[model samples]
Target chain A: MTTTTTRTSTAGAASTRRTRSSDTPFVTFEQANRRLKWALLAPALGFVGLMIAFPLVFTINLSLTDAFGAVNAGNSYVGLQNFADALTDTRRFWPAVGRTVTFTLGAVVLETVLGLALAMLMRKAFRGMEIVRTILMVPLLATPVAIGILWMLILDPTNGIANHLLGFVGIPPQEFLGSVSQSLPTLMLIDVWQWTPMMTVLLLAGLTTLPEEPEEAARVDGANAWQRFVHIILPMLRTTILTALVLRGVDALKTFDLIYATKGPGGGSDFEAETLNVYAYGLTFDYQEYGLASAVLVLFTLFIVAIVVVLRRRTERSAS
Target chain B: MTHVLRPRAARGIELSRRSFGVLAATSVLAACAGSPRTASPDAPLRVLAINHVWTQAISRYLPELEERIGRRVSLRMLTADQLTSSFNVKLNASATDIDVMTIRPLQDQMMFARNGWIADLTDRVEGDADYRWTDFQDAPRERSITAGAAVSVPVVTERPALYYRKDLLEEFGGAPRTLDDMLDIALETQRRSEGFFGFVGRGQRAGAVTQWSSFLYSFGGDFTVDGRSGIGTPEAVAAYEFYGRLLHDAGPPGATNMSLEQAMPIFAQGKAAMYVDADAIYSNFLDTSISTVTDTVGFAPFPAGQAGSVPHNIPSWSLAVNEFSLLRDDSWEFLRWASSPEMVARLQSEGIPGARQSVWDDPATLASFPADLAEAMRINAANGVGHDRPEVMQVGRARDIVGRPLVSGIVGEDVASVAADADAEFNDFLVRDNRQQEF
Candidate 1:
């Protein structure tokens, strides 16, 4: 009681001093408090500016120049020439864009669907639920490169266990990642395998937080399990699903490690699995076409932003 | 008690804040001072190198180098791609930390040389008579020079050696000397029904180009002819078609996906009859842990085509002083010591081929290699072309362009049309690349 009284009195004395000093063009307590607030916020704002704003601005500027080979080397302003070149590059750029979209859509859609299913299946209390959840988390915890290598081993056309298992079932051996046509789809499946558990975990958390009254009411009204799930649970889970979609969708769109680890530069012999991320990486590091790479990156960033905006708008509309 | 302790807690926070500010200021001052132009007396000479056999072997004997230089030595090894990326990033910023760099002359030397990332070593290499720059093989020596300046010294030389199963080839009268005979043997022995392939090699577009360069040269097809794209030529088309046919018919399923890593294992596991790749990898076949065909493996020169057998004899890895190095003298000394005749001979005797002609000429080095492999290496080295990929500023891009036809052929697409398309694209690339280089 004495300590609180002493601290309060000290604060009041400080406030009185500030107020008295205000007549002499000195800062008042409000002004001082405002300044202190900004002082504390300045570092975080500066950090955000440095980390996010600077690279973005630098990349945009680089996109306008003919920067090649070395980052510190002399380069001339090429205007929109790099952008024009990238836009016209049917060889690598456009195909990469197509693959990126296809992969993201294929992988994210599959992951969301499967994740939601698994989430619901394990939502209620069940035997060995923790063990199953732990097992599911294993793929999510493993490194992408390690997972890629593991999948490569499992999917090896001639020598893999997958083929051996298929043979036991009297089925023909299939080239999973090795075939050009199959490479992208196989990688998508691998992505789905690695990331579905993440979605499941996220959705399961959302599931537990639900009021359960609506579900219970629907159940008492004698609605079918599928009807309740479709009409009630899914509608209630919109925000979580959209949030998970945005997370997994963006990640899938930028997938590089697994593809690079499995197929390597230019994404295989025919550039079969070259997504935009891989294409941009090849341009910057492998080919040293920094200008083109920056242009591609700028375009890629805009593309991602456009997607997030659309998704955000959809989420808002749904919420409203 | 709380009121009494308040001022003390405030004082403690103020002290911590002041200490942090001082530490930050000190760090800023230290950063501003930067690294010294000349390294401190105790500082280790840093060498950035690829994780190769030569690097592995030299690491064991680094103490000798350190003793000679009277300085500590720090060697860091990374994979080929990682090494290139590291150089690109570090050298671009003009980092002085890397005293010596291991580089691929054909792959990135042009870019590095043009960017002024590697120091010009003409005077050091030529002026030192004892060093005997001429003692290096002609092809690798020629490759080491970029833009008319000796920027690097060849250390590890590579040439493709035909790896074959001696047991499989015994009835076919040993390894084929001619391309046609090799194809015939491959086709006949490819028992896909019995789960064995007749031939296995790199088929991935970019990775295949280097190994295919030997085939291209043997077929009288260079990547360029008179500074123009030559892949459209009949010889180039034939080479592509031949390689495609060999892989498509005799190679294992999913051959298009196989690179050195994937294809080598197939041969090592006794699943393939013949494999053509860099001689540097011969040890993989002899290693008991990986190889099922250890006793059955045979080595031969690249098979003859329209032109006689000609393989790529390249300085697959070379030592160059980083242009921004603070310790150029030490770096050159390290390079000199590493590529010295005695050192080269010693390394070669242990089966890592050195660029020194004298070391290759010495029969003592040959004693360590499998007798047949040494013979094949001797032949291939003598009849080798200087480069394995298209010589251009953007080698990776050029390889991708040049390799498109190879993939088409492997997948049973028409070679001529694909070659024509690739040729046109490559020509356009060459023009653009040349324009970029001029800048």
Candidate 2:
């Protein structure tokens, strides 16, 4: 009994000695600061895991099954059939993908150029600059669906003030929302009007955070104002530009409310305005093709992720 | 490690338990979404209705209906469009927030019935002593069949009739009796009149489809016969050609964009010399807020084509019990009391059309009607057409493919070519939606 107790005490003493020696050299300030930063980041990591990662996993699972309308007993594990079908089907899935690409590309390109102009215009501080910025934020602050409705009323073919003004020019009544050929471009214009302000605000914020020293140096080195802006300010704002593009691109791809409010389900008779998001919505609600919709959503999410990754890489390259 | 993690682990388990409790409670409460079936006589039967002329009927009958049925009743209103696109989908999937649903046969009976979202009210309708199935009109009752079962109780019936300017017809020597006479008037009126459309009709795809269907049906043409597209035939092509010519010569430029909403306003503004649509619009003209040509308007049957005279069938909303409804007993009681002959009389007193044949024959009701309403009801009672595709399953897609493009064609799209386009779409829908099986 005494021998056994002595052996156990010896083992315990050895572990304590090891722990004491490890603690003797205190952590350096830089190391502590690095550890603290990571510690601070832990909560954000946990948040992303819960909000983004968990839902993504759930969505992936939903995509692989034939879960349909009313949540009845007919949900079957259909493997990758839904994904395969979505890639091939013409009724909604493929057309929606085309619409999403067009809308995202169209909206992003226009907003980027328009937003840059607005940002540059406001960059030079003058009288009422604050007031002009405040006015520019109105479209961004307006709810999308509400703005869509407001635009609808203004663009009404018969009763609208737009036609009333057009009549003065002898251009006979034109069907705005009522015409199939014109509806998509009309919706795009409305989207641009509402979201360009948002892009402008973001780019403006980025412009404010940019260092003035590089731009001043370029000006001193015999560069004109336009040349300095093109060579110096544009390169410096690359990260911010990429970030804005990615953020706005994702939202544009998923645009639902404005189109829905304007055209309604099946996207106004011919589905002229249906984006990928709207198509998924119609599948889930109008047709109750839940499995197909889930598949479409899953693939759409992948496309969005690919875009984000490419943008992120570009941002990293620009930083370097 | 154990000492440090013990409290944290304990708290995590407690938090999980609390969250589970909340979730379980929410699930239970959400599952029990509809009203309870077995309510006391003193409690009100929660009723859902559309806000229209129907509301007038409900308001008039509720006090007497409550006393007669020995149950208190209440109502909530929604638009017909709202019921289909948004409300029904939401109500059916989750807890049925509705007990009694007011629906149109076009959407409610067909679409809702197909997905098994609606209840099998056959037993309730057939077994109930107070329902009095024999008292119901044949045309309206026949509309309830979906998948070989009756799913709705029809409230009102509508038939197409001509609303021409009495002054114009008298000035032109007579009203049109057949398709030829109608064409003659159109040609003559356009030649004589300036800045006026001789024949005003909806030319927008959705609206023009209705106009085309009437013409097609009148000429013995149809979308399907023996479960195949009835387009690409001589008679169908001839009908399409006639409609195209009529619109090209007599209808206004840019008529392709015109809809019922646009058509009504134009007709009311005296820009249209003649108009044809459902009988329901007669009341719209009477409404002080809308019409300027109410007094000058005259009524006639839709012009007869070669095979038969086509009357556009505009379906009114019907009352149907939700299958998920727990308040089946109260719902049936309310339906019976509200739809009875006596109740219909009260409704008719306020200009709400009743679905009963008896109400149609009532002398007081007949005497109370304006000449236009009386003429419309007489036509409706004698012969009113329903939808060609009455089956509840995928009829929506079928209607859109067949009807929408036809209407679009009216607005200067090639009528013959577009008719072919519509036919192809119809054939595809019939095959894909399993509509062929129904035939």
Candidate 3:
């Protein structure tokens, strides 16, 4: 017992001496470098913190105020009055929210379905496959504002080629963007055209990474092409599909540029094309209702967060 | 860990280093973008102007104006929408990147003055003996004044007038002399003319307000009385209904989307017998490149309303010194010289409507435009009102309030009820803003 205690004390003393030596001027290059790396990261971390925290806090604070117009240039805090007003605002707020949801859902569903079809089409190797892929990406690369203007010219009721083409088929001219009901749907079609290529590329990558054993096994069992796609390929591509939906959905919910370019302020004529993003922008800049805009943005952010959480959970569950 | 490929690891390290460098450079670029490029006071005087034809004409004379003023002026032009939106942003934040800014006195003078964005040029105008402030047309000069202070220096002035086909009017017996006469002529011309409308003017909401105001005034309705909306009055409602009747019954197809930009070309193309629009677009009508009826187009005063022939003879463009600018004096110098009699004559000759009475009166300059057009301008300028649109800081909101009714009226809605609704909305806006309750 005495010998064992002496050995343990001696071992502890040796470790203590080693630890002290390690902390002194004889510190190794790797240890010193590790400490130095954190010092280097400090500024970047601080910058990112400032970038996020400042706006987050500022927006939250502003959301509680009644800051509107030139007279109320963001001073008097009204304590969730703006939020209450927005929550009950059937006229502007609720309508905008409905449009946002419809636009996002319409765009995402179309993009995902179209993207999958496109992915399936491009999965097999063929001559000029590169060219085909490049063609799909053309609209995505074009400036959104330019696209909007181009579409505007194409949809112009008086002189547009859309009406001209319809006239060829003996159909009456349609007010694609001009009509109150047609504007949002027309914008969704544009969005789908622009973003479907992105989803296709993402899904294509996922397809390439997917193991072919299950599909092959199903094919060997005399399963039809439809059966293999539904039972084997689809089950494997769930994560990729969910990822595409989340990506496309997030962007769709925040659509502003195309709407702004096409419709201008207050979302055209009678606010027909106004979604939450456009509504927020008009309030913030056009009318200078900063507080109300901030409230709307905050609510919009929470909504996005809630949606992403659900999507991410589903993605994780399938992955697991 | 078992077999780390040195070359591959080296490539990975190189890639990350390159990425880090790119990130750092991006950060630097972002920082630079956020910072405004400010010039020293002694540097060229920065004049932010709208990208209008008048401003384009002025751009040609900038070098000469700079030499005469003994200071170089750098002119940066933006579209009308950009100027209105961006200037408000910068001015509201008290940024002095811009020294002189273009303004529509009828639209923005009251707003700018209320916000203390523009310097009050009352004392300065009174002090500058050689500036010839008296030479400016009274209507525009009055419009530039806010709370008895000169906040805007008028440059390009315009008034709405009747433009008609000389051949058509001759065939129809004579020019319209009253609202009733004008409407009858319009109906007859529309019925008689093949593949052409009788009248063309702005019909879009917000856009139609100014053109509609001519009709509104003719019917003996003022915009406001004692800070209450005067649009709901019998005269105003009647005027709106009459306006609706003309457009709904005789104007072009898809007239709901037509503004002066679209309507002017329609008239100039001989598709319409008569057009009522700003004097600035007169040059467009004269430009043979686009106008089909340039030779046949004749100018006349607006047909008499109950208030007699009154059209808005207001400055389409004005220059204001930024109150936040350190170079206010330099900006004022540029403005004064730009709007001076000598410059006005040049500008007028160049086909930009000038604010100077002397420029319009000069026989040489007057000859530049048709004699009938010049006469119309002279007569209208003499009887011009102080403001065209609502005299309020919230001009755009007011226009929309007024425009909604105008649009509804044209579409065959109950104009009386629409006018009442518009009045209520306008009143609510004023009450909320704590501004003057009416236009």
Candidate 4:
């Protein structure tokens, strides 16, 4: 009915416009409508162009130059020497790449598994559910830097609550973030603690959206709870799981604040916890190697894009 | 209804277009009409500084500065790293908002001067007689000059001092005067105390370099000798190994990760027998809230090595005018007032050390400090080197390379081989750094 009314009104408007004199100053109504649509969209398009496109293009251009120290300082174009330098750099670049991958994979995998399990357990409403939900949101609410500091205090080797608790259990004190070997793993745990709740919330929403009929039908067919979940609920939740993976994966790859706050520049003495994001930041701000930093950023951007594209493809496939 | 809606929709579009044009015009007008100049007649003299004791002590007397200059003063303080980041982002774009900046002459003066981010203060500092530019100590005063121009004026100077437990050291015949005695006392103290450490200092790769420089110098070595890498020298290797052995055997379990923020607490809490760090942080040992060994803490000159005690007497912080600032004259006025003889003496009496030699010379100012600490500071200052870290354009990267062997020592690795490797790396970095400077 709405479509019919809109069609009739448009026809009436066209007929009314046709009755006007051909020598009128205004163009046809269709042409004016088209121009008006573009004029309205121009500002938003301009903003996107300025904010996103310009910086990305500028960074790519910078990657090809020998920009150093101040941004406005005189610098000559050095072609792809910066990229070649980064690619060949085993000391910092490769180690940072390895760390970024290790951190993202370890943190995301744990978050997804734990989040899915928690979401399943909490799917049904029970006593004091709201309070439990609120408690789960605490980690998500705190700033990353604040969380990093809190974790550092808790995990301090000599005089921390974590060591105190371990001592009660007859375990020796473990250097969590302090030891170079343990820094990355400790950061992964912190990431898991802070972000698992977000994953649970997302998966819970997905769980709520799942149809109950299929599960009921499987239960009625002599399937157990685990069987019904595996046969029915899991298959249906594939798209949501993949969506959550993409969202969380992208975020995990770009983690900086917590790592920087806890481990500091070059990600501790040995650059043990220095991921790609932190490395790029150190190069750009700390060392003022803008040209080299830009090259690393461009490469990092492409790496993230490639991962996102692969994940998105899987999501679409699961949805189909 | 559709015919009526079409004209209204078109009119809405037309209104939006008109509004956009008006908004665009207003934005252009706003862009052209800049904010009131910070240097203007009645505007505040804006200062960006690090959140240090010097900045804190000076902040209380800002009203005096304002009264003298006949203008309001706006001082904003940030952590050292935060201040550096702010300067890099702001000065890169030639920001005029910051009139005066507290800078690290040794760490960032070269870069800032090279980039022309800081104004040349040679004329203002030298031409004014009462300001007494030469009154500043030789080591710190020499550091203020970048490329033959006085780019910054030293405000706070630092040197390494031995912080020992007075109570613990009495059993070992007081503070050790030599490196060997210090190590022996540290080892004996560690052997007696179950959970306590013998010696604690910075061990982090980059953060440890400045403190380690004193040891390097006393060991008859330097970061560079005649513009070449010096870390592979026998003296340098011995220095690195001795530092590593000191920490690895008698220091805490995670000494490799401890910088000032981590290591200072151990000494303050009476968990370590001997600690060496900047003299600027002596108050941390005396602060009731943070220190448990206030009464027991003792200060001594940096322990003598093969070449005797040669600590780093360097300008830790300084004040400079932003090159792009419109209030350069007013900024100069603030600098001169802050660094003047009377002001430095006043601040020094309150326990904030100043760069002026006259302040150090005054017995009245020395009265505020514990007698031993004052003596230590005096001796260290007289015998200190100008620069602590590697003197290069990329100081951060250079420190990292120079400090790799230090970390190796702390982690109980072979120091000689690591020093050789790091020495090679540092030489390569210096060559590249020199090339960049030429650019």
Candidate 5:
């Protein structure tokens, strides 16, 4: 009984103190409070500095030197030569960049549009929403290499079920991944099928946490569902959309396992699926051109960072 | 108000501080825990072998190996590509994960030996009274060892030769003995057959390059003369042009992307009249599970080029021990048992080819194999066509240089331009790779 009474009195006293302090302007405890806040944030700031910042600096430094294979013998300090070579080297580098951009853009756009539609459809309760959601997560969690192999078997021109099914509809057979022109697009479809669920889940979370008053108010002001969603809901979800785009863009740029699993070194006979990440890996492991691969990786990292920064800036502006 | 805020901030700080303090304390304590890979000074030595049918053959004799050496033996199976980079990486980084491994003799030897990744097994071979390098044919032994230095023992001998459908040959004016005859036969047969290709070989850069190199070598077009680019000659161009035409007319629809394994099915399904590939495919074709037309198979030497059937000797697989391996003696004991004449006979009876020379002469072994298959092996072994040399170490670059562009051209995309461009690129690679240093 005594402890309860003391706790109530202490809470009352704190509230009273707060009320009194709000009446005063320019409190003198600001400096101490600011110092304490900074001290609390130091660990996370330091962790990011060490793990992310340090390695990036190290990679940049390594990129400047010519180091091949495990042996550091015959290494020459060739500043900016790696960058120049990466830009001009036609056998493996520039083609890789082109592939990277195509893959990222294709995957991001398709996944976003599909994910948005799915999220909207599943917004309300359904008979087996949980089961459907669980089924969607299977592809996301499954290994990319295993998925590549499964797709390879499914897309085999001779005995695949895909062509068999197409035949039933009186459609001529198509060379899916085997065709030079079709491989990248086929991979994009695969990327969308595997990852759209992740985007859907993220958007759904954003939707649930959304304040209802603004949407309800719009509905009352002679607005249809589409009008309210376009004018209010979409604008409100800009930050979440931006987050999804950035995440997907970064991953799609570094897609290695799927391409490697499907096409061996040099990204198939014609190099139809040779993206930047796969190119760098092939250079390092297959060719033992470590210096060249390291240089390519550094350029690729900068390109990804630039993309992320642009997306983040747009996200921040919209959020504000 | 300041006092109230102070309590909340202090609570936050206390919670963080307590968690961080606990983590720091526990990590410091945990640092003194027991280790994972403590060495047993008195423990019996362990041996690891590279994987394949070769490993399967070696595994059979491990009991004999353990009995002889009085130590434990362990074998691992890794694909050809896995064993290559892993062996190199493990040698550089850990120095322990691998003790013994299999490597392709030519490409792996120079890098491995120059980096001191492999020990000089010359001493071991010389010291062992029973060890006989002379027992093997001189050319293969020369290809396996480096500058008279035996670093590893050869496991399996493979050579690339021509394989054809006997039935198809009978239908298409009989077997081709010359390059012109082969081309003529292919052209004539493809005109008559509805869906069947006259000749199906690798048209993919790396795959086709191996097949192309044999023709080039046979036509007296060397890749390097005293370690310089000799691939720019008329003979080389003729060889490249011949294959390009072959791809254009008589090869399969997707022949430009096909490897030997990929082309095998087409031939096995009776869609392809002929294929030129490694001897390992011999078993694959004979296997009842996969092959459809195994009974109609005919093997022959690679048809005569301008210089007459100079078979291109492609090195298959060999086993090498790591420099820092503790079980050097035990590893050799296993290799000896694995490569013995009796064991070779046993493996040969089961349809596995052996690296030993004595197995080649055995009547029983020859009796078990098809007459054509035996004849092809004997000719390849006799000719020294598919041998590995120091110059072949640049095969990776060569595939891109001589191979990739050739493939792009053969696909009818941009034939001459791609070839010229590849020539320029390969020239630069050759100069940069210090390819001239091989001499």
Candidate 6:
């Protein structure tokens, strides 16, 4: 028994000595814990910073220079000239900004409202609900370029299913993609068709997690569905709604694939559907004006961030 | 404790080292085994080709090319625009990968020559007695020089042609010989038919610039004269008006937004009576499977305007050696062989339009293609201008500037004012290009 006790004491003493040798007493357990926490997170934090900050810094640098196409071996620095040029050019940049805003707002607003309605409808259980859910996922899961081509064929003025259906109603063919005036709205509708499902899925998830007590109590108190939804359900879904808004709005702002696939380059022939993203791509690759393209991208980023900020503030106020 | 931990940690590290060594060795062996490239790095002649029809034809004769050059050749083919953009990036990096690349002689290739991006073949051509550099037809051979350097070899000279329906023309009247005559024929034809259009051409902004240039030149105007913007001239305005009036009043309803891709289908399917496009796309018209009116489709020179007919007689694509290439001698051998008279004749026999006097003038070539089409192509080739779009480093930007007004014209906006606005932009373009870039 004495030998056993002595061995336990010695082991404990060795462990204590190790602890003392590894770190000074000045660093308490809490301080060591804080250090361990930081050390654990260092790699992820560093990766995130490098991924986010590196491209941003490089883009800003390119924006400030007079970097042109591939031949810009030196890319002679002409500070802020590109920015000035892009800002003053009422012909291309300003018009592209207007288009970007219009496309984003139209797509996001419609998607959110439609998504909410869809989520509400989908909340109730029904036969083949899983199949319906899977069906809803199809558009979101489709390749964007394939979708664009499919829509192009379906909306073809002379030979398309859309026109064929219209003919049955004794209606004339509509110039959907061909007409410049109609192209933007048509593209917006396409965006809504594709992305509304994403919002529906997100809001559906939010709806599932909501507390049932308030809803039941409201039902017992003789409140109607609309009233309860407006006063309680909506209020509780603030974070979920914001999440959907930011995700959808940001994606809509950066919409390039569908538009590019539908229209060749520089938006359509007349630049009818050109957003700032498309314009920047044209500047960078088509025209080889890298410096000017970078400036446009920078300004576009600012515009997107400003929009998100404004949206967040409005949502916060409404939620409160 | 230190003594115990030391051996364990060392053993772990030693195991890791052995594993890493094995992995590295295995990877090295796999890479060597999997790589299909067998020729010595310096021996393989790297050729970059754009997927133009002419290049597609060239691809068919690669075995013959290898025999003629007496070297192993590796060809990299990319789509037209992708090749162009990638070529610029590759050249900027001074990469020695591509020994030869397909280029345009006058349009954008001159800019490469000015920047010393391509090798000058002047000495090589002048020294070779059998190469016969002068036999590539005067117009195409002359365009081969850029900044006084012979940078490229001609392959195919593409000229715009008016494709018309013989049956439709016979019913309406004889083929229209002039612009005004065409207008009358188109209007009458349109009025008489239910699903037929009088005329159709490209109307997209950028690509339209090339087709639109034929109109501008026929109306006795040009994009520039001695480095001055000529878009505001009365002749240019007249051209725009006539072009716009034809598409809006006589052509199909949606012709305003059509490119050659869309316009050709309507013509081939017998929806439109006529189409004006590059002779390079002749296959699209001649293919029995694609063209319903192939039997009735007849080729003609562009109808005369006030200045008579002028079409783009430029080489749509060319092959040039990269200046930075280590295999310049090998690339030269490929160019010399592929552009040789016998090789060209072989291709011409297969219906590839070779950019040479001998090829177009050969009896076999004329018989191989349509005889009437050959005659017209030969005449247009002899007379067409060297550059359709502005021959400058900033050609794309300049095209966009001049092209916007063309869009406005198609869409029924006041094109005169649009041209005025574009002219101002064009003038600015000239200054910017001169101030900043070289070619």
Interface C-alpha root-mean-square deviation, candidates in order:
7.5, 11.7, 13.6, 6.9, 9.1, 9.8
Native-vs-model 2 lDDT? 0.69
Off by over 4 Å in 5: A1-61, A72-76, A167-173, A212-225, B1-50, B127-129, B184-196, B388-394, B414-417, B435-439
TM-score of chain A of each: 0.89, 0.82, 0.88, 0.91, 0.82, 0.83
Estimate the TM-score of every prediction.
0.93, 0.81, 0.85, 0.93, 0.83, 0.86
User: Model 2 clash pairs?
Assistant: B110-B392
User: Which pairs of residues collide in model 5?
Assistant: B51-B77, B312-B385, B312-B386, B313-B385, B313-B386, B313-B387, B314-B386
Error of 4 at B248 (Å): 0.8
Give lDDT tens digits, candidate 6, residues B1-439: 1211222323322222345557556755774463233335447789999877667777777887787667778888897667877777788767778889988775567567755678999998878989888888776787888767788888877888888889889865656778888878777777422546788888777878888888888889999877888998999988888888777766765554567767788788887777888887877778989889879888888778999888778877888998888878878988898898988888877777877786776788667677667776876776688778876677777878888877777777898998998898898888877775554
Candidates' C-alpha lDDT? 0.90, 0.69, 0.78, 0.89, 0.71, 0.79
lDDT tens digits, residues A1-320, model 2? 01111224556556544643474322223333555565566568757966899777866877888765443424678999999998988966777788789888987889998999999888878999888888888888989889987976687664567777888998776668766777777887888888888888888899999989998888888899889878998888888888999999989888999987777666665666778888888776655566777888898889999988998998888888
Q: Provide the lDDT at B337 for model 2.
A: 65
The backbone clash count of each candidate, in order, is 0, 1, 2, 0, 7, 0
Over A35-118, each residue of candidate 5 has an lDDT whose tens digit, in order, gives: 455566767876786689977776677678876645344567789888898999885677878888999899989999889889
lDDT of 3 by residue, B83-186 (tens): 88777778766777788999988877776677678898998887888887888878888787888889888988888888998898896666787888888888
Candidate number that wins on lDDT, 1 or 2: 1
Better candidate number, 2 or 3, judged by TM-score:
3
Q: Give me the overall lDDT of model 1.
A: 0.90
Q: What is the C-alpha DockQ of each candidate?
A: 0.35, 0.14, 0.09, 0.36, 0.16, 0.21
lDDT of 2 at A5: 19
Tell how far residue B101 is off in model 6, in angstroms: 2.0
What interface Cα RMSD is found for model 3? Answer: 13.6
Docking class of 3: incorrect
TM-score of chain B of 1: 0.93
- Across residues B265-331, which tens digit of lDDT does each residue of candidate 1 receive? 8899899999999999999999999999889999998999989998899999999999988888999
